[model samples]
Target chain A: MNAAAAYLTSFLRASYRDAVAGWNRFWFAPTDPATLAMIRILAGAMLLYTHLVWTIDLEAFFGPHSWVSPTANATFHEVPKISEIMEQDPYRGRSFVWSLFDVAKTSQQIWAVHIVALVTFALLTVGLWTRVVAVLAWIFAVSYVQRAQGALFGLDQINTMLAMYLMVGPSGACYSLDAWLARRKNPRRGAASPSTSANIAIRLMQLHMCVIYMFAGIGKFVGASWWNGTGLWGGVANLEYQSLDATWLAYWPHLSAFLSHLTVYWEVFYCVLIWPRALRPWMLLIAVPLHLGIAFFMGMITFGLIMLVGNLAFVSPESVRATVSWLFRRTRPAPTTGG
Target chain B: METSSRPKADDRHQACCPWPNELRIVVSLLLALHVSAIYVGPFSMGAMGVTSPLALTLRRTYRPYLEAISTQYQGYQFFNEPGPSHLIRYELEFADGREMVTGKLPDIDEHWPRLRYHRHFMLTETAYTLVSRTAPPTPPPGLEVGTPAYESWRQFRDADAALSRAFLKSYAEHLMSVHGASLVRLYGIERRYPTPEEVVDGIRPGDKRFVSEELLDTFTIDIEVVSP
Candidate 1:
């Protein structure tokens, strides 16, 4: 009995040690800031572009006289929209505070607030006081979403999450003006060092992204249309997104079903399959093309691109560094022969 | 570059990402709040198994702050329907008594640089986001269809209908005024068009078979708003 108890204790100790070691490696291992920095620039550009698009019909959508007035927009959060009697989201409630709607009443006020938002996004892209700018960028993103909750799509949601996550990381660490300034002062600051904040930020994005896919997949599974294997066909054929009439897909019904089922399966399994070392490459192969197809076929190119870029958080910083170095070497002019 | 007395790799690793333990705890807490507030709603908890009272408390506590963020996560419940029900059609009657009908609108079928106005479609869809609550007001106690109790339900529904009519009148007025019309007529279609299961079997778009001639709701925009 003594021998058995001693063995059990020894086994428990070893298991605990192993688990602690694994936890530390997963969470605290030093990660290059370059990956987070890259996401910052891309997501920042997306931010500016997303807000700039609002300028197209700014008055028409955000103006008080527009179809959905400010009061209606506010009520959108609280009650089911009368027009949309079929689709009701019980989870949402009326937002109590609105930074954008409360402050800007007229077009000029809206434009003024918009211009300042654009400037904030521009500064964040260049990494000036990134810590401060990141927070402001998130606020700007939230304000737009709140003011025009009716005008939101998947891309808008993705942009908000990316901006939120960017604020959490040391995203301005490398490939940024902050890095250049730091290097100038220290002279020995490595361009590709790890930042704990960056790692934490990336991890949050990673986990959040997994959750997103899992839900997206599960939502698809629950819908009767997806099970019938006609969801993709409906999306493609919808007149609202009829850029290139993919009605030809109707002719190939089996092919359409295959694509639909593939999407559902891919999304549901993404959270599980993406974690394995061997399966990651496979996941990327399926994911990258899927979003690209969404961009080309759905005419939501920006939204698709943003979703694809968000997936890059799963990539190791080492791989990101190597890709950057390769691009630089290829673009660099052939070394000039000494005259 | 320093050639002598250079720090070893271990020293460099320690310095590279020296994130203090305290900050990690703080950020982790914030992330938890964020996740709870945004994703742990009544509808979304099916996958995460977040039914506990503690989770409910955390969601209620942080939900206000989360809702304030721009990153609204209603989830992409798109293309999950058997078919779209709302088909908005516009009609205009000129002072001369000539009438015109159009299915195309600036934000729906024809918007410049198509991508820009996709949000218009999304906005319309947002108006119809699926809330699991009952779509119709239940009949009053001891009330059956065609009875006075049924009329009470009808009144409740009409109240909602009036509100919707006002919102659409503002938009339809904008559309009709552009077409030089004096009177505005709008139609809201409630359709359960054939599902993917019904039509995916070699059905073509030119067939014009999916759209049924069933008129669900036909209401005139009786209110007057700005023409432009």
Candidate 2:
């Protein structure tokens, strides 16, 4: 048993080292300017959206007593019964833990955290104080996730992983206001670090995304509802909550069951096989349709599209360009790099 | 002559672009895909136009509490319900000392009448059940009754199921008239009630059946209208 445990520990340590080294070589190698530029722009855009979306109110997303600010006091709607965890028999013993949140609920504490998180996310997007802002965003996001584990959706999970990845280096490497200003002040210092910094960040993000997908697929496998094809059925059944028409799905009685079975299989099989080069494209292809179906049938557009973006990591740069060129005839001029 | 010029230009471009042409093509494609995603992708994602009044209104209503809770809690709830709508939703308190409710409410627009009718009807039915269960055997002798007292129910003939049913319906209708047509409707309450026997059967002795037993306790009535 000790030998087995030691083997597992050693294996994990080796994988971590390999991951960091591989990421450095691939993502921040200073060879693929386009890849680097793409990463910067994409990450920036997502961060910008995260901030801009919050220009309204942040409390709407979570309850008054968030993990980030449990002492917050305010009267809002009851926190939703997100999981069977609360309803589970064993969990009854720990019911007091849940009720404690109600007694200490405060909107102020939540608001304070929101202010910092939003500002940090915005700064990170603009690449201002890049590393510091990245760490701050990660900290804030983790705090939020812990407050209501059940309330967490896919987008929050993805962003939390993103915060961790961005910690490795200055994501403000290109196309940032930070980069433009740096160029004017000192042109020689405009380039990204030749060290493995970006690679570390990008690799973590990629691995983090893989874990998310694998976990999601695993969750689906454990669910009888997903296997029965009614996993997506519950949303469509509630007409008041539905943003789109999904009554047709229920009409075909057998289809729901079939879909549930297929969904579970896809999730489980993809989780285990996604890393293989031979199967990666196929897995992504399947996921794209599945995600798209989710967007259309369940009104989960944001999450479905975000997952699609994550799957883009599996796509080779060559294929992505080919696909883009085929769709749009306009060719982008190459950037001029000094000899 | 054109072919000759094309080769020279191609050679010059090849010399300039050390990165594979394929790489440039792929980058452009990826950018286009991303840009397209921001456009006609799915749902109403990229369709938010600044000038659209509907969008603006939605933004105004939605924006007030978007930052109130952490993004960790993204779920729905009623505008004002007894409990939170979902596990993830949080309440927001503005600096001005007012509570802010966020998330979507059940769509009542399509079933407005049904919902309205049911709301007050259920309350009335519940009131009747409580009265039937807890009403004393008799009012105190020589006591003066108020306008809202249950005395009006005394005029009806007893020991007749039909008479009792009619009496209950009439009483409900009278309440509706007084409450205003907008406030009370018959469709809101189910006409059926559990018979005394059904209530008694539900009681398991030794269990907490005292509430049901108290409800089943017999009573006698003697009401008179002395004035007019």
Candidate 3:
């Protein structure tokens, strides 16, 4: 048993290291203002939008009369959301195992924490006091999720992961007022100017994203739905649960099953393939489409897009330059030999 | 002299502009679109594939609105003709005999307490009057059908649940604050990820005897929310 534990630990560590190395090769470009700006704004806007939708009374679609809410509670029934099991049910312990960490309370103190979270998200988006904002946003998001207990929705999980990623990345390095100010304070600092702090931060984010994907995939495998090739199909097909028909999946019902099987394989195998030198780029390319599918089809646009952005961490500067130039229709000039 | 002349060819080349361009505005627009899609996009469109933004906007702009016409207040029941949006009219009652009807308030001079609107759909003709001694005024018709009130109710429930969980946590710590741990004991439930069965068992204890099954019939999951 001890040997098995060691083997598992070693495997996870290898996976982690491989994922980081891939990220460094693919994603770590000499910090660009444009890329950084887009990431921060997108993340911030998503946070704000979630809060707005949650706070508003636009119940026409999700109201009691609408299909989602149950008028009278039932003992045992099919859940209205496919993600509910993955997102909420795992934590629905009967007794409070760790009550102090639980924020499920109506106390003024709890509300105060919520307010702080709202502020933290706002600050994190604008890149104002970014380091502090990142810390606070991560804390607040995790705490809010913890407070929601087992009732947490998919968005909460996504938000928690996003915050975790942001804490380790150069999320506030560009397009932020803070970044602009920092640049102004030190005009000579250029893209190639490396700071120990920023380097550490970026590396951490890359490592964190790898773990997130690997763990998520591992969790899916643990569930029967993934193994049976019914998870993705069920998610797309259920009427009360699915937000859209996506019934086009029926035309190639076999395709749906294939996709589900593919997802599980991709998740589990991604951890293995992400680290291999020859296969890393191909694996990343596949990941791009998978994430896009999630964004486009799952009403999980934010999560998909964010994960895609996180995948960018695997790209290297030279390769990125080549890719960018190719995308922009630019040709590289020939190098002069000892001019 | 020729080599010295080459030195002056251009110091300006060394000062090349390498700063990356700003994509903030474009990114911001895309983010805004992504967020708005939640409301305007086909409710199910999100679950399908990228919903058409144009279609989403059109649906939102053209969505129907429910309006309320009249309201009547009675002893334990409130009656209101909340215009066309409501399918069934409603009356609310309290255990203490205080009730409000669907119609207008008693005083016309004050606009604050007036019934603004009413609308309901997908609800049966049944009436529900929660007989709570401490319950606040049952939510109004227009309010109940809307998302805000429901979310508020969820928030309220979550907050209350949190408090209950906390109260159970410090069972030993608060022992001295009271007479002793013996006087007041709190048992925290140890449910390590509750299954559907556990949630049901917790809400409805099997020990209670029912006089008739008809009372229990109200607990059916298929019952729809009546909108008045």
True contacts kept of each: 0.32, 0.00, 0.00
Question: What is candidate 3's CA lDDT for residue A158?
Answer: 47
The chain B TM-scores of all candidates, as shown, are: 0.56, 0.17, 0.17
Off by over 4 Å in 2: A1-55, A58-116, A146-151, A183-195, A251-259, A316-339, B1-228
Which parts of model 1 are misplaced by more than 4 Å?
A: A1-24, A80-97, A181-188, A333-339, B1-17, B36-62, B70-73, B85-87, B92-103, B106-110, B128-134, B137-184, B189-203, B206-209, B212-228
Tell me the lDDT of model 2 at B117.
Answer: 19
List, residue by residue over A40-118, the lDDT tens digit for candidate 3. 5666666755544433222221222221122121101111211221123332322111211233233344445555667
lDDT of 2 by residue, A1-339 (tens): 999999999999999967745533344343222233345445545655644454342443344322112222121112211121112222221211222234324666556666767777777766677667767766666555444332334555555555655675556665466778888899788455433354445444555455455444544543355644555555454332244665565556577667656656666566467778888878887888787876665555555666666665556545644665665655666677999
Instruction: Supply the TM-score for candidate 2.
Output: 0.45
lDDT for each residue of candidate 3 in B124-145, tens digit (9 for 90 to 100): 1111111111123354456664
Model 2 DockQ (Cα-based): 0.02
DockQ of each: 0.27, 0.02, 0.02
* Candidate 3 local Cα displacement, residue A49, angstroms: 3.0
Q: Pick the candidate with the highest TM-score.
A: 1
Q: All candidates' TM-scores?
A: 0.78, 0.45, 0.44
Task: Kindly give the stretch of ten consecutive residues in candidate 1 chain A with the minimal lDDT sum.
Answer: A80-89
User: Worst ten-residue run, lDDT, model 1 chain B?
Assistant: B126-135
